[model samples]
Target: MTRSESVRRAGIENKPSSAEMDNIYYTAQQLDTKLLSASIIGWE
Candidate 1:
Protein backbone atom coordinates (compact mmCIF):
# COMPACT_ATOMS: atom_id res chain seq x y z
CA MET A 1 0.00 0.00 0.00
CA THR A 2 0.93 3.64 -0.47
CA ARG A 3 2.32 5.78 2.35
CA SER A 4 -0.87 7.76 2.85
CA GLU A 5 -2.86 4.56 2.88
CA SER A 6 -0.53 3.13 5.46
CA VAL A 7 -0.75 6.27 7.56
CA ARG A 8 -4.52 6.25 7.42
CA ARG A 9 -4.63 2.60 8.39
CA ALA A 10 -2.23 3.22 11.22
CA GLY A 11 -4.37 6.09 12.43
CA ILE A 12 -7.36 3.77 12.49
CA GLU A 13 -5.45 1.10 14.35
CA ASN A 14 -3.61 3.37 16.78
CA LYS A 15 -6.31 5.99 17.34
CA PRO A 16 -4.19 9.00 16.56
CA SER A 17 -6.15 11.83 15.00
CA SER A 18 -5.48 13.20 11.52
CA ALA A 19 -4.07 16.34 13.05
CA GLU A 20 -1.42 14.32 14.82
CA MET A 21 -0.45 12.61 11.60
CA ASP A 22 -0.22 15.97 9.83
CA ASN A 23 1.95 17.33 12.60
CA ILE A 24 4.22 14.33 12.47
CA TYR A 25 4.53 14.50 8.71
CA TYR A 26 5.21 18.24 8.77
CA THR A 27 7.83 18.01 11.49
CA ALA A 28 9.59 15.05 9.87
CA GLN A 29 9.57 16.77 6.51
CA GLN A 30 11.13 19.90 7.97
CA LEU A 31 13.87 17.88 9.60
CA ASP A 32 14.47 15.65 6.54
CA THR A 33 15.35 12.88 8.94
CA LYS A 34 13.09 10.05 7.82
CA LEU A 35 10.04 8.95 5.92
CA LEU A 36 6.65 9.66 7.54
CA SER A 37 6.10 5.96 8.13
CA ALA A 38 9.33 5.72 10.07
CA SER A 39 8.28 8.59 12.27
CA ILE A 40 4.88 7.03 12.71
CA ILE A 41 6.46 3.76 13.73
CA GLY A 42 8.62 5.58 16.22
CA TRP A 43 5.56 7.33 17.58
CA GLU A 44 3.77 4.04 18.11
Candidate 2:
Protein backbone atom coordinates (compact mmCIF):
# COMPACT_ATOMS: atom_id res chain seq x y z
CA MET A 1 0.00 0.00 0.00
CA THR A 2 0.97 3.61 -0.48
CA ARG A 3 2.31 5.62 2.44
CA SER A 4 -0.77 7.81 2.57
CA GLU A 5 -3.01 4.78 2.50
CA SER A 6 -1.02 3.15 5.28
CA VAL A 7 -1.23 6.30 7.38
CA ARG A 8 -4.96 6.53 6.74
CA ARG A 9 -5.46 2.91 7.67
CA ALA A 10 -3.52 3.53 10.89
CA GLY A 11 -5.65 6.63 11.65
CA ILE A 12 -2.87 9.17 12.05
CA GLU A 13 -4.95 12.07 10.71
CA ASN A 14 -5.39 13.56 14.13
CA LYS A 15 -2.89 16.36 14.60
CA PRO A 16 0.30 15.34 16.33
CA SER A 17 2.06 17.39 18.97
CA SER A 18 5.16 19.39 18.03
CA ALA A 19 7.38 16.97 19.87
CA GLU A 20 5.84 14.02 18.08
CA MET A 21 6.32 15.69 14.72
CA ASP A 22 9.90 16.55 15.61
CA ASN A 23 10.63 12.97 16.55
CA ILE A 24 9.03 11.63 13.38
CA TYR A 25 10.94 14.09 11.19
CA TYR A 26 14.17 13.33 12.99
CA THR A 27 13.75 9.60 12.55
CA ALA A 28 12.85 9.97 8.90
CA GLN A 29 15.88 12.18 8.24
CA GLN A 30 18.15 9.76 10.02
CA LEU A 31 16.79 6.86 8.03
CA ASP A 32 17.17 8.83 4.81
CA THR A 33 20.78 9.67 5.59
CA LYS A 34 21.57 6.09 6.47
CA LEU A 35 20.00 4.86 3.24
CA LEU A 36 21.99 7.39 1.25
CA SER A 37 25.16 6.36 2.98
CA ALA A 38 24.47 2.70 2.33
CA SER A 39 23.82 3.46 -1.33
CA ILE A 40 27.10 5.34 -1.58
CA ILE A 41 28.86 2.40 0.02
CA GLY A 42 27.21 0.07 -2.52
CA TRP A 43 26.33 -2.40 0.20
CA GLU A 44 23.79 -5.16 -0.10
Candidate 3:
Protein backbone atom coordinates (compact mmCIF):
# COMPACT_ATOMS: atom_id res chain seq x y z
CA MET A 1 0.00 0.00 0.00
CA THR A 2 2.69 2.44 -0.99
CA ARG A 3 2.23 5.72 -2.93
CA SER A 4 3.40 4.04 -6.16
CA GLU A 5 0.82 1.27 -5.77
CA SER A 6 -2.00 3.79 -5.23
CA VAL A 7 -0.91 5.78 -8.29
CA ARG A 8 -0.88 2.63 -10.45
CA ARG A 9 -4.48 1.73 -9.45
CA ALA A 10 -5.84 5.16 -10.40
CA GLY A 11 -5.06 4.36 -14.11
CA ILE A 12 -4.17 7.87 -15.23
CA GLU A 13 -0.44 7.02 -15.45
CA ASN A 14 0.08 9.87 -12.99
CA LYS A 15 -2.17 11.97 -10.79
CA PRO A 16 -2.54 15.70 -11.40
CA SER A 17 -0.18 17.93 -9.44
CA SER A 18 -1.56 20.32 -6.82
CA ALA A 19 -0.69 23.35 -8.97
CA GLU A 20 -2.65 21.97 -11.94
CA MET A 21 -5.71 21.17 -9.78
CA ASP A 22 -5.68 24.57 -8.02
CA ASN A 23 -4.93 26.67 -11.12
CA ILE A 24 -7.10 29.72 -11.87
CA TYR A 25 -8.52 30.55 -15.30
CA TYR A 26 -9.49 33.89 -16.73
CA THR A 27 -12.45 34.71 -19.02
CA ALA A 28 -12.90 37.79 -21.13
CA GLN A 29 -16.01 40.04 -20.93
CA GLN A 30 -17.66 41.21 -24.11
CA LEU A 31 -20.40 43.59 -25.27
CA ASP A 32 -21.91 45.25 -22.16
CA THR A 33 -25.43 46.55 -22.71
CA LYS A 34 -28.53 47.78 -20.88
CA LEU A 35 -32.00 46.24 -20.14
CA LEU A 36 -30.51 42.74 -19.56
CA SER A 37 -29.80 42.32 -23.24
CA ALA A 38 -26.21 41.22 -22.58
CA SER A 39 -26.98 37.69 -21.39
CA ILE A 40 -29.96 37.29 -23.71
CA ILE A 41 -27.78 38.10 -26.72
CA GLY A 42 -25.03 35.67 -25.44
CA TRP A 43 -22.43 38.42 -25.04
CA GLU A 44 -21.24 37.08 -21.70
Candidate 4:
Protein backbone atom coordinates (compact mmCIF):
# COMPACT_ATOMS: atom_id res chain seq x y z
CA MET A 1 0.00 0.00 0.00
CA THR A 2 3.06 2.19 -0.03
CA ARG A 3 2.38 3.25 -3.61
CA SER A 4 -0.89 5.13 -3.77
CA GLU A 5 -2.33 8.47 -4.79
CA SER A 6 -0.16 10.07 -2.09
CA VAL A 7 3.04 8.70 -3.59
CA ARG A 8 1.88 9.59 -7.09
CA ARG A 9 1.28 13.17 -5.98
CA ALA A 10 4.90 13.91 -6.85
CA GLY A 11 4.61 12.35 -10.27
CA ILE A 12 1.77 12.00 -12.75
CA GLU A 13 -1.61 10.60 -11.75
CA ASN A 14 -1.25 7.09 -13.02
CA LYS A 15 -4.70 5.56 -12.77
CA PRO A 16 -7.20 3.92 -15.07
CA SER A 17 -10.26 5.79 -16.23
CA SER A 18 -13.65 5.34 -14.55
CA ALA A 19 -14.94 3.13 -17.34
CA GLU A 20 -11.71 1.13 -17.36
CA MET A 21 -12.00 0.61 -13.64
CA ASP A 22 -15.43 -0.87 -14.13
CA ASN A 23 -14.02 -3.33 -16.63
CA ILE A 24 -11.12 -4.29 -14.41
CA TYR A 25 -13.38 -4.79 -11.46
CA TYR A 26 -15.78 -6.80 -13.57
CA THR A 27 -13.33 -8.84 -15.59
CA ALA A 28 -11.16 -11.62 -14.20
CA GLN A 29 -7.35 -11.63 -14.13
CA GLN A 30 -7.45 -11.10 -17.86
CA LEU A 31 -5.98 -7.64 -17.75
CA ASP A 32 -3.36 -6.18 -20.07
CA THR A 33 -6.01 -5.90 -22.73
CA LYS A 34 -5.26 -2.20 -22.89
CA LEU A 35 -1.93 -0.75 -23.87
CA LEU A 36 -1.59 0.71 -20.37
CA SER A 37 -3.71 -1.70 -18.35
CA ALA A 38 -4.07 -0.95 -14.66
CA SER A 39 -4.07 -4.47 -13.30
CA ILE A 40 -3.20 -4.82 -9.63
CA ILE A 41 -2.99 -7.93 -7.44
CA GLY A 42 -3.94 -7.74 -3.80
CA TRP A 43 -2.47 -10.34 -1.45
CA GLU A 44 -4.12 -8.92 1.60
Top TM-score hit: 2
lDDT of 4 by residue, 1-44 (tens): 46676668778677889999988886744543442353334322
Model 1: lDDT equals: 0.75
Clash count for candidate 1 is 0
Quick one: RMSD of model 4?
Answer: 11.3
* lDDT comparing candidate 2 with the true structure: 0.91
Off by over 4 Å in 1: 1-14, 33-44
- What clash count goes with each model? 0, 0, 0, 0
lDDT of 3 by residue, 1-44 (tens): 98878889887586557775554211112223342586787766
Quantify all predictions' global Cα lDDT against the true fold. 0.75, 0.91, 0.56, 0.63
Which portions of model 3 show Cα errors greater than 4 Å? Answer: 14-44
Question: What C-alpha lDDT, on a 0 to 100 scale, does residue 10 get in candidate 3?
Answer: 80
Q: What's each prediction's TM-score?
A: 0.39, 0.64, 0.27, 0.34
Off by over 4 Å in 2: 1-13
Error (Å) of candidate 4 at residue 39 is 23
Instruction: Report how far off residue 2 is in candidate 4 (Å).
Output: 18
Ranking of candidates on lDDT, top first:
2, 1, 4, 3
Task: Say which candidate scores most in lDDT.
Answer: 2
Q: Which ranking of candidates, highest TM-score first? A: 2, 1, 4, 3
